[model samples]
Target chain A: MKVKAYITLKEGVLDPQGKAVEHALLSLGFQGVSGVRVGKYITFDIQVRSEAQARDQVEKMCQKLLANTTIESYQFEIIQS
Target chain B: MKFGVVIFPGSNCDRDCVHVAQTVSGNKVESLWHKETSLPRLDCLIIPGGFSYGDYLRPGAIAHFSPIMPEVKAFAERGGLVLGICNGFQILVETGLLPGALMRNVSLKFICDRVTLEIENNKLPFTCRYPAHSLVSMPIAHMEGNYFADSETLKRIEDNNQVVFRYHGDNPNGSLHSIAGVCNEKGNVLGMMPHPERVAETLLGGQDGRLLFESII
Candidate 1:
């Protein structure tokens, strides 16, 4: 099984990188862009017997390592192939 | 006093810390490897600076799981003195030993310069040598040193007098409350972004940082 995860800074947390990109975009004449936020995308393979088990495992991984609950939030999808 | 400095794979300041410890105390100073699961008996332990684990994902995120961290946590729990500087501070936060997180600088720049810091609380085992409300200059070098915490947590930390140092004149990284250093509730664990070890010697530029080492003695 393969899993894909998106990790993002929680709302109300300042995203300096995202803000910088937004400024660049506006300066480049791409207007009407708002609420820019930067995040991380990660993918990994896991060996599991069931989707439920994979979800549980990924949740633990996100909580312990992939995402710091204090500042970031994460969501993932388990892909069966 | 016996001192130990933990060396992670990418820790560049491990030797600097050892040098300070040896010079300050003239006592036994050991360099503990990150793979070791146990620690030798010591009066103080230092997690020095540098790009530990290549600062992958997040600074100190990977190194938090190093085999030595469990021992470090245990040592802190026992009220043994622990000092984490720069990257070491990030690891302490990731390990939950310290509150808050170090975010990217507001300007997103790597700041490396000597800055003035106000000693907020000189009563801890770490800052006891300094006079109350005294100011000192030390070098701070880091990209992710802006400290952030929720309102409630910040209030608790402030109410408990956990903030040990605050940027005096300039908020270099736009840290919340201008916090440059903080300690755990028990005041046994300290995490700060400045490199006091770098300025421990007179030839390094200043001797103000030596007072911190003297505080421990």
Candidate 2:
């Protein structure tokens, strides 16, 4: 099965990269942008059999490696396709 | 006192750290490779700054999984003194040895210059030689030195007196609350963006950074 994880800095944590991107976009003639927050999207292929197992494994991965729980959070979804 | 400095594949400041520790502490400093599973018995362990693994993904990302990290974690858990400087600080964050993460500079540029730092907490084993609120000038060279943490964590750190250093004048990286350095709850581990080793001698421009190493001794 394939799983996708969305990792982002927790709300209220300053996102400097996101802000810089927003500034660059505005400078390039893009307007009406209020804000921007950047994040990481990771896709992994695992051998898990069930969605429950996938979720558990992915959460463990996030806690141990994928995310810095002190400032960021991660969520993963198992894809059937 | 004996000191050990971890050397990752792309670490450029290991020699600098070794030289400073040797000079200031008057001790023999050992360079431990990242693949080693054991750390030498020592009075202190230092993770020096540099582009570890060329900072392939994010700063300190690839180096976090280095084989020696587990031993480093164990050393910290045993209340051993650990100091991470600049890229070392980022590695500490990546290893979960310290709170918060270092994001890109708010200005989106690599910052390299001498800046003043306020010694916020002098109780740690690393900063015992400095007085509270003492201003010391040190050089910081990094592209991702902006520190970020959640509000609750920030409050907890403040309450626990974990904040050890803050920017004295203009905040260079837009770090939250101008935090330049922080210690762990046990006060044995410290991570900071400033390069104290770089300014440890008068010939290097100033000797203010010597106090940090002196404190450890």
TM-score of chain B of each: 0.99, 0.98
C-alpha lDDT score of every prediction, in listed order: 0.95, 0.90
Off by over 4 Å in 1: none
DockQ of 1: 0.84
Candidate 1 positional error at B96, Å:
0.2
* lDDT for each residue of candidate 2 in A1-81, tens digit (9 for 90 to 100): 899999887877777778888888999989988568788999989987788898899998888777777667788889886
Residues A1-81 of candidate 1 have per-residue lDDT tens digits of 999999999999999999999999999999899889999999999999999999999999999999988889899999998
Compared with the true structure, what per-residue lDDT tens digits does model 1 show for residues B42-150?
A: 8999999999999999999999999999999999999999999999999999999999999999989999999999999999988999999999999999999999998
* Per-residue lDDT of candidate 2, residues B1-217 (tens digit): 8899999988999999999999987878999999999887887999999999898757887789999999999999998999999999999989889998898888879999889999999988899999888999999999999988877888999899998999988999989889999988999999999999988999988888889999998
What is the total number of backbone clashes in candidate 2?
0
- Candidate 2 global TM-score: 0.91
Return model 1's CA RMSD, one decimal. Answer: 0.7
Best by lDDT: 1
Q: Candidate 1 docking category?
A: high
Give the runs in model 2 whose Cα sits over 4 Å from its true position.
Answer: A26-31
Residue pairs in candidate 2 whose N, alpha carbon or C atoms collide under 3 angstroms: none
